[model samples]
Target: MIKIITKVTLAVLLLAVSVSKAQNFQGQAFYKSKTNMDGSLKIESSSMTEEMKQKFMESMKKEFEKEYILTFNKSESVYEEEQKLDAPEPSAGGMMIKMENSNDGKIYKNIKDKVSITEEEFFGKEFLITDSLSTYQWKIEGESKKIGEYTCYKATYTIPVSEKEKEEYANFKNKQTDSKTQFLMMDEPKEQLISVWYTPEIPISNGPGEYWGLPGLILEASFDKTVVLCSKLILNPKDKLIIKVPKTGKKVTKSEYESLVQKQMELMNSQRGDGKDGIRIEVHR
Candidate 1:
């Protein structure tokens, strides 16, 4: 009994040490999105924290969940329509974040509400959009540079929409005439590119938008010229952050969600000054 107890104690101590090392540091990240000439969007994400890792880990869950609504200036439009900003369009559909210190450690998570077009749930639906919207291969190219005190690397990718893609886009537009659903449409592809600057210094693989799996942290990223940034990075916070995913809104996949929104928009357009934009449909299990 004594020998067995001693072995368990040693194993527990080793496990604790390993976990401590993993959560010992934290950093900040910034991301941006842009459009290429070919009707696709690009994204970049960077990490920008130097000495403080814990503070960032603690508050990051809450900070990253906050939305940054963006609007395009008409004068700044690359395409004539791109400049005609009608409303706040979503760049990052919605995000679900889960942070754990250890495999079984406490989890901090947050799920934001996506603006629902139909009263449908979007929780587990696979996004209708494909990674094919943009085709760009990126490679970590050259020595690291400093951005706001943290070292970052240069990674580049280019997106091009071909002739076949254009034909397919035309087909989708043909369906928009009297259709109640709004499918993903690509009108032009002249400005689609994604560039990223990251640092493997922090040792974590996560960032805003679809940027992830880098060796270090992402500090600054840009997709075309639309930018998302980590305005601040905190490290070694005295308190551990606790996050709970919210279940208040309907869940849908990215493409389906977009489709639902289009349906609602067309419905509203048809009603035009009649003033009936709120209709609720509930599903009972």
Candidate 2:
């Protein structure tokens, strides 16, 4: 009788261990992001009426607010924006103006390997940008807050603009002949301060869109003019989530992609007479 009891106990322990391991390997997090559009719309336009500009700004604001889903496991994650119905293009002065959606891409990050791959589309051309994962020196503030049912702690970091970004900004400015518009672009800072809230309960050092290296999953992050917040989380769903790296598109490093884009912009500018008269191009990183 004693030998039989020991065998049953061992079997139950093995089953429990297997279940725990499975639970720790998969999760899905839903996030909603919004950007502050007030600064961007503050520029004075000579040709556009105030009412028309206000209407255009409203339309642009809608594009800045978006929804995303992050599927993650122990060491890897795939983050992509959720699909939504397209709205009609907003018109000003009898011309239809379209806002460029900057956050259209699939970001795959592998924390264990310290690598990141992003599939991006520019001017109808697709690119796969592979590079090292960015590391952050987070200063934990020892403050805590609750995001839904999970408790989160505060952390902050600073990031300086790269030379590539500076070059892009300069190119964008040179294309603008309006002094007011150029001044607005020049007012943008060269560095940004980021604040994040993460929960250790989840035990994953990943977040949405180039944010990671925290002690847990980031529930909320704010930097520059954008804020991303976690709205929901699901753990170990019945249907397994497969995290795969993007394989299609022209593969290039981060710096290489920037150079390619800059060269294309220069070519386009040279072809057009007084390119400043055309639609404004906002450089998106």
Candidate 3:
């Protein structure tokens, strides 16, 4: 009887392992912007930095230009609320974020460099978005880690000033790109350390954030010190969607394009409230 019980336990454990391995990591993206000096996370546009506002407008402009056909599947559970099976939140402690991934090709449209092709160009039209304006030497450094039961290799990419990058930096130093912020100078290299975690268990060359070119799926990613975690996996769910990059729009590099957007946003803000007689509210107590 004891032998039978032991055999049953072993069988159950093996089954669980098989099920876990079969599950693919399928869930909506949850983004948590780093906190601010006030110890709070600002969600709206009215409370963003000039650079942040510029990037936001740039995204909008790219969408308008590309006009890519976009679609999204309904939200799956984020798994935050364990008590409630129907509706699960990603994080139960403190604040759990709810976000949708910009799945369509439009998200890549703004990337504009050596990323992907659009729908407009001829058979062999070359559209160099960022014209070798800079080249930063990047290195991968870190320890190996495991995201799920899968073993993952962790690495850090450092943005250093290469020869081409320095030249662009000098050009930007002479003139400000726009009123929002000055461009990076050759000597002044802004360092950004991105931690990438990829597992060879899943054979796909993709990741959560900007890090890519791995043998398998990227389980987690971090940029500018903000972390994006993959909490769940859903293997081979029905109604699988295909990812194809679109190609039907005028191309523009990220930096130059963002400057144009910043100007427009600044103009709008000026009209709304530029230190002169802002929103008037008379509260009667």
Candidate 4:
């Protein structure tokens, strides 16, 4: 009897190890992202015609509505946008949407290392931004909801707007066109609070790009007129995924990269110089 009991205990231990090895290391989460265009669209426009607004929203749709895949493990994760062939961008009165990040942009984070690296393109130049992980002072609220099969809880953090962001947004208004009407679409963003729903079932403190340190896997996140929600969860696929850290690009710290980008924007803004002819839109993502 003693020999049989010992064998049973050892077998159970082996089975537990096998289960952990199979389901706990790495997985993929698919997310659907969309911008809250309603705020901009609802801004009362006395001078801009409805036709102008429609054309502008149509052009902005492609840039804002997107799909992304996040592949994560115990401590490291990679987040990247999924690319699709897009139709030719529409334009209205020389006004158009321009994205600063390249289609190949990717963000990788290592929670154990407390670091993040981003691969992005700016003005035909590729950049690898390396920085310490930005932490959020998350306040867990007593709110819970069902996301898929898991129960998700809400947590939030708020960061003040940067002076540079404020200055750029202040300049984002329509120029005096030859038409009789004029309007301003953007409002200075205030109290930039972010909310995320996380589930403890996954037990990975990871989420979409730049969002981490949650108690569980973040299922949905929203901030600054944009929302990203996990649409599918695939845990422990047949083939193991390798989380490869990005190695290509000009290496620079996050602050250094932002400075370079600001310099380029200054040059462009000087050239743009309050043009007196058509609509102007400056959107930062």
Candidate 5:
């Protein structure tokens, strides 16, 4: 009886090990991101001709569409953009704007540890921003939809506009000489509604960019004028994932990083004669 019991216990242990190994899975998810540029063009100079405006809008549209890859496991993920070669220079009056997108850098998120490390570059300087993971109070609805081959459930969350955002909005509104531009700026919401479609079939509480805390992998997410959709997914590829936290750059918290960026922008603006038409910058992930 003792021998039999010992054998059974050893068999159970082996089964547990096998299960653990199976659960330690890794995959890669490809995402495509696009931003709406209509409202942005409306805020441009009213004196510009329609043809010039159309050209500018067309140039901006190409910048708005981007591709990213999220390599993740059950608890951790690293999201980054696939590097691209530089495009040809823009036409006169078509300023090349450096807009922020979802694929900023090596954003490492560990769900089990509830921590995140984001490596970002500002004006040629790298900063390692470390902070606690943002926990979203997601309201999961009964609605369901399909993104590609995966069935996804709908979820919603509201993000309050920060003081910086409010100030930027006010500045843009004030600078608009045209009534239509002012009206369009005013129509923009103070709070952005984030909509997500997650698939329980993936069984991983992970998503692209800064979004997570869902019951499953997020296949689609939209907030403000930006939308990110998963274009491809590969589960348990033969290549093992090496998840590592970024260690380079000046370490700072999220708020600290924002403050630093704001100060830098202010300095730049002051150096540029405080011109209202200098550049409107917004960072999103």
Candidate 6:
């Protein structure tokens, strides 16, 4: 009995040491994130041919094809974009269409303390948005897939769409009654089902962007018209990285930050009120 007890104690010590080593190291993950435009783009220009329009759409698609890096330890993570060379500016005829993508900000999450902070820059000003970490009710499915060397399991959640946005999209689609305009109507749902693939081999309850709280590290996520896939992962490199909280912007709650952004967008729209000058404020979720 004493020999068996000694063996069990030694095994437990070895397990503890391995877990400590695994949790203390830092890791980096590369992701390619692409989000499609919510509604079909309608550009009414007599100077543009169908081929020109197609080229313009391709350019627009390239705009959203972005790369991001997620640097993480056991309890905290920082997710930000990887900068690339700028493409030539797209030329639009007859009108200036202005839009905003709120997802360009940097996000930091600390799962140990249940806290999150995002540094957002808008029109030259930066704001720090502080809030609680997001809690997702992810339903794990029996399905499995492989992303690189790790096998990932499927999980999903849902995001409900608002009625006002639905009405606005419907109106935009039906406004093609004019003789000079052509509109393409599409069927959009009231809720978007978000899916993710996670691997328990890298056992950290974190992921890229505003997603986390799984039993493992999320390797890929799909939602709305966007898909964020992990292209590469490096664990425990030669040089260690510092994972710290963000603290460079005006501090505010998440709701307060969103309200301020809405007001600023409204002011900009009113200032640029012109028939040919169109301003559209888009906040991607």
Q: Per-residue CA lDDT of candidate 3, range 160-203, in tens?
A: 55675566557545543433331111235466666767777765
Please write out the lDDT profile of model 6 over residues 1-285, one tens digit for every residue: 999999999999999999889778689999999887645444444457776666655556666778999999999999998977865565444323223444768899999999999998877788899999988999998899888899999999987777756765575455434322222223454687989999999988899899999989999999867899999999998889888788888999987986786566445544543324332222334
Error (Å) of candidate 4 at residue 26 is 1.3
Residue runs of model 1 more than 4 Å from their true location after superposition: 1-19, 24-137, 159-168, 171-186, 265-285
The numbered model that scores best in TM-score is 2
Model 3 regions lying over 4 Å from their true place: 1-114, 117-138, 160-189, 238-240, 246-256, 265-274, 277-285
For residue 184, what is the lDDT in candidate 1? 25
Worst lDDT run of 10 residues, candidate 6, spans: 176-185
Q: Best-fitting candidate, measured by lDDT?
A: 2
Displacement of the residue 120 alpha carbon in candidate 4, Å: 1.0
In order, the Cα lDDT scores of the candidates are 0.40, 0.80, 0.42, 0.79, 0.77, 0.77
Candidates in order, TM-scores: namely 0.46, 0.80, 0.43, 0.79, 0.77, 0.79
The TM-score, computed over Cα atoms with residue i paired to residue i, of candidate 5 is 0.77
Q: Which ten residues in a row have the lowest lDDT in candidate 4?
A: 175-184
* Local accuracy of candidate 4 as per-residue lDDT tens digits, 119-221: 9899978899999999899999989999989999999998987887787666543332332323233456677889999999888899987999987999999
Whose lDDT is higher: candidate 2's or candidate 5's? 2
| Cα shift from native, residue 282, model 3 (Å) | 27
In order, what is each prediction's RMSD in angstroms?
A: 17.4, 4.3, 14.1, 5.1, 4.9, 5.0
lDDT of candidate 1 over 1-285, digit per residue (tens): 999999999999999997886655432232233322222222212232322222333333232233321111111100000123444322222222232211111111111211211122233332222221212366778967887777889776766777755765575466456544231223444546666777666566544444444566556667643455544454434554322222334444445555554555445444432323321111111
Query: What value does the lDDT take at residue 251 in candidate 1?
Result: 44
lDDT of 6 at 194: 86
Sort by TM-score, best first: what order? 2, 4, 6, 5, 1, 3
| Higher-scoring candidate on TM-score, 5 or 6 | 6
Tell me the lDDT of model 2 at 155.
98
> Candidate 3, after superposition: displacement of residue 217 in Å?
2.1
**C-alpha lDDT of candidate 1 relative to the true structure:** 0.40
